[model samples]
Target chain A: MPHLIVEYSSNLEGFPEAHALDALNATIIASGQVQYEQDLKSRTIRTEQFVIGNDPTALRGFVHAELRLLAGRTPEVKRDLSERIAAVLRELTPHPEGMLVQLSVDIVDMDRAAYYKGTL
Target chain B: MPHLIVEYSSNLEGFPEAHALDALNATIIASGQVQYEQDLKSRTIRTEQFVIGNDPTALRGFVHAELRLLAGRTPEVKRDLSERIAAVLRELTPHPEGMLVQLSVDIVDMDRAAYYKGTL
Candidate 1:
């Protein structure tokens, strides 16, 4: 199972979340790393409030993504995937007039043993 | 760095996100796990669209949280913290009639060496 969770600052008013999400999904599918494309779950969360480096007055924003996959991949794979995802996010986020937007991508490993899929 | 990110189902008509966020921060502070309470930034993301187990008709919702902490803590500490956070989320989310809500908490370790603080 793979899940992509994106959290972006509210300051990025013009960002296209849904489009970026689809692009991310496409990137993952193109990687050929997943068993089934339909099983990939992706969602976004807008951060209404945030601060950067102790400066509330600073015009700063961020777009952070977390990609969680069932455990099995080596550390190298995670690293490469994270870098690619970061590039996707960075490209998608616009460099507005005066705001600083930090983009980050984190690759997470979900425990395989505890992971379950069944009817509830 | 410590950040609490909560992603919940938008179906929770009456779920108090801001208030529940405060309670979660209080719970973490009470745990005495972090160095500074001020550094702990909490935020919520509402999931507008989601599917549960290939069933579009299923009346189900979920509130999943990710607590990102700087690397150093032992697995035991992370597990205990996750459990406490889960409890807080469950207590805060209302069990609306006929809908099932799943609560989950994930403790993530952020690489300390790569973490940086800077002014732009």
Candidate 2:
């Protein structure tokens, strides 16, 4: 199984609706790759704000979404999971014109030594 | 410019000496890519421990080292940087036999919108 962590950066904050998180969770579950279903999980999205320019009065912040999944270790499976995540994020927050949204995905291969019984 | 995050998983903890972090910082500075020089930086290394088996008492934890670098975006440059990091980590922590030391490296392309004034 793999633990996936998706980190995204955007210029908008406090605009993502509550359903956005739900939609992300649903997308992952629907993929039929992860085992845990009862407890659909999410971390408190942390934002780091910055000023792009003083004259334009532009502001930007990064929102990182970390999702832990237990799945098989295969190249095709990893690619599919990454695409699904990118698609979900695009649906959740589409950036404005002249803006950039960067998404970085990480997969942790959970071996026997890395598995735990209780919550982390 | 790119922000690099190196996540490594191993089966040993509380064994890495204090100089390990210093060695990492020194390697990055010696790379001569990052601009900020006065403040050699590092975050507290966090560990997540797990047991492989009760009888053997095999334990594992993950060490994530995040480094921010500002350089021109080029494929060769990126490759060189990644290889340099992998080498440094290898020197820092060499794993035992039959154990898998997984290292996942991520790079954040810092654009105009993502630049900040002060510390994050």
Candidate 3:
């Protein structure tokens, strides 16, 4: 199971959050990476209070994503997944006029033994 | 820079998101871990859409946290930080009484060389 969390600045007006999630889930499912539809739980968060670097008045914005997966996939598969994710991220590049847009994606793998999934 | 993200289920009502961040920041600063006050960027996201395991109607909830840091601190330091974080997480123990509360913390260190800090 992989968890994807996308955090973006509030000023970004053109970022299609819901559409991007749909595309990502579709892409991941197409890759045959996950077995079930609900295996991937993704969410987005709007970062209203944040300080980017040292500039207090830089008029900057960022959309950063983190995907955590249980250790099993090869490095190449992860790279491919991240590349696809970055492609989706690029769709919102230069979202707001006259603002610096920072887009980044990180793919992380948790140890299979340490990662635990349980039901109530 | 270390980014802290706390994701909790909507069912958990007693988790004071703002308060927990304040305490975490204070604890990290009190430990003399970071040089600047703004070095830490944290945000909370309420998971309104999520599926826990295979249970569709379990009345379950989870409070998961991720702390991402640059690679410089020793394992002992990271362990200490996680322990302190877990302690803070425990403050809201049995948060809403009956529902199962899954609490977890993950301390991840990124390669210092790969980490970049920039301004617009």
Candidate 4:
């Protein structure tokens, strides 16, 4: 199981939520590395306060995603996944006059022993 | 560099923001496993919509924290860090009647080559 947390800077406008979610879900499904598409949990969070580099006043926007997956995938697969996610974000986020943007994706392993899920 | 992302359900009331942050920062600093206290980036995000287990209708709340650090830390250190973070969250989060609360922490390794931080 993998949970994708999408964190975007609140300074940005016109975020394509549906398109980005569909693209990411499709990317993971098409990779054939996941057990099921249903298991892929995705959520987006807009951060009002964030620091990029040292300049907080600069017109900067970022789309940072964290993907938590069950341990076992090879390093190559994780790297590829992170790169692909970043690429999708770069394509989806809008750019306006005097704005700088950065995109990053992190693929982290989940320890099955520590993770607990109860019946809903 | 390590980044700690705290994601908490928005439905919960009276979240102890200052206490949680200080406790976490202090926990990491006291562990002596990190390069420096300044190197740890901590941020809190309130999620508007989140699903735990299966039923979305249940009045359930969760505090999920993700810790990303350089890839050389031992497994023991990571586990200890995760547990300590979870314990701090449990102590800090307020519990109301009829609310099912769960706390979880994840410690993830960062690939130094892939993680990019520009001049701030």
Ranking of models by lDDT: 1, 4, 3, 2
lDDT of 1 by residue, B1-104 (tens): 47788888888887788777777877887788866555566778788988768777779998999999878999999998999999898888988888988899
TM-score of chain B of each: 0.94, 0.63, 0.86, 0.90
> In candidate 4, which residue pairs clash?
A53-B120, A54-B120
- Taking chain A of model 3 alone, its TM-score versus the true chain A equals 0.87
Query: Which tens-of-lDDT digit does each residue in A32-85 have in candidate 1?
Result: 778889878899977885543333455667777878888787767777677677
**Fnat per model, in the order given?**
0.07, 0.00, 0.06, 0.07
Between prediction 1 and prediction 4, which has the larger lDDT? Answer: 1
Clashing pairs in 3: none
Better of 2 and 4 by lDDT: 4
Q: Which whole-number lDDT from 0 to 100 does residue A2 have in model 3?
A: 82
Model 3 lDDT per residue over B57-110, tens place: 677888888888877889999988888877887785346756778888898886
Kindly report which residue stretches of model 3 are placed more than 4 angstroms away from their true locations once superposed.
A1-6, A11-45, A48-120, B53-58, B92-94
Among incorrect, acceptable, medium and high, the docking class of model 3 is incorrect
Give per-residue CA lDDT, model 2, range A1-120, as digits (tens).
333343433345543646666666678778877677645565333332221211123333333344444434465665565566656666666465554444433333344666665765
C-alpha positional error of residue A13 in candidate 3 after TM-score superposition, expressed in Å: 6.3
| DockQ-based ranking | 1, 4, 3, 2
lDDT of 4 by residue, B5-111 (tens): 88777766788877788899899878887776788889888777454433345566766788888787777778778877877888888777787766667776778
Q: Which candidate has the highest TM-score of all?
A: 1
Isolated chain A TM-score, each model: 0.93, 0.66, 0.87, 0.89
